[model samples]
Target: TYAETKFIEAEAEFLVANSGSFQATGANAAAYEAYLEGIRANMDKLGVSQADRDAYLSDPNVAVGTANLTMELIMKEKYKALFLNPETFNDLRRYNFDDTIFRGLELPEDHNSVLNGQWIQRAVYPSSEFSRNEDQVRQAEKAIDQPMWFYN
Candidate 1:
């Protein structure tokens, strides 16, 4: 979706600035624009009324300018916009489930004990895969709580 693309653009621009390849001012400006566009695109997709969209976007909390923009805010918006998406799970893993980036996120009270109070890193392979290709599946097997290489 266009909204997802805009969110990705916002993240890329913000990360580029942090990586020192671009000036913070210019990169943040681009990121901020992309962030707002992402929200607008998602709202449009959902058929939100124009007046409601305008009111939400113009709210003080949502309209925080470039200088106040942070990776947390970008990710939070992306999380909200992509609710229940597989990409959200992938993103949570990418960020190692850091609460700072995903405000209000909390571990389930009865989460798997294998996690030892940490977030689950990834889903286990389906049982059918292990049954069909035991050798390959065993080779790739990891603890349920172990972090994947994709983590930052």
Candidate 2:
């Protein structure tokens, strides 16, 4: 069981490494490197063999590029790592789909239509419930068509 968990952790680390160059700036690089180090250290603490780490690191199909690594690539790797996880759905919703990568085509002209612009910023409260809680519901509804305060 320990070995299996280690292998999965190693795979996640390999993904972060493969997805980008090491020269990230701002908090992005710091956060990613911290995560990578945590995974690798955990494996070491768990006594995972160097051979296992090498096996994952050496995989040929893993994309490793020093110059072309980017946030987009990291996100793609993250998406793969999150397979079957509930957070994957949230990730999909938050990361606007890049039609070229997701569908192999550009967005249709209708994408710009008012009805298809950005998604509704929030959901409307049920009418019956809103009627019962008039003042509180009205305040909450103010955020429906706009980004939440945190997002703003």
Candidate 3:
């Protein structure tokens, strides 16, 4: 499930990145157009049916003027691509939107939260250190709960 979600997220991010390319000059625009065409071709090869593709392409809500694509549109495509993957949670975390119900007013308080804050950057080293290097393990243990330079 996680893998599926990640795939969707990656696909969405790729589309977002691709659309952003239009902000470039003539040469860049040509290159990005080619890239988008390639993506459409590949999606077809992957068995995404013509009807679905047309649905996405024709959706009025997804239109971005001459751009024809936007982050929200791409994200909708991604959600379809992911289907039933638990990894969508990771995407949610990275986007900092796991709890849309709260609308950013609250966040989960757990080791995962470290990902959104400073502690994650200073995670404890692997417990394997205890078996092969006791002294190093002890030193690391002392620093486990402390913040790193980035946090400061």
- Per-prediction count of colliding residue pairs? 0, 0, 4
Q: What is the per-residue lDDT of model 1 for residues 74-141, given as tens digits with 9 covering 90 to 100?
A: 78889888998999988788777878778888999998887778898878999999879999999999
lDDT assessment of candidate 3 = 0.44
RMSD of 2: 8.7
Q: 1 or 3, which is superior by lDDT?
A: 1
**Model 2 pairs whose backbones collide:** none
Those runs of model 1 whose alpha carbons end farther than 4 Å from true positions after fitting are 20-27, 150-152
lDDT of 3 by residue, 5-102 (tens): 34344444444556534222222233334434434554675778888866755556533333443333333445555447654444443443423311
Prediction 2 global C-alpha lDDT: 0.45
- lDDT string, candidate 2, 35-119, tens digits: 3443345456657798985565445433343333333434444444444666544433443444422334244556535435664
What are the RMSD figures for all models against the true structure?
2.9, 8.7, 8.1
Which 10 consecutive positions of candidate 2 have the poorest summed lDDT? 20-29
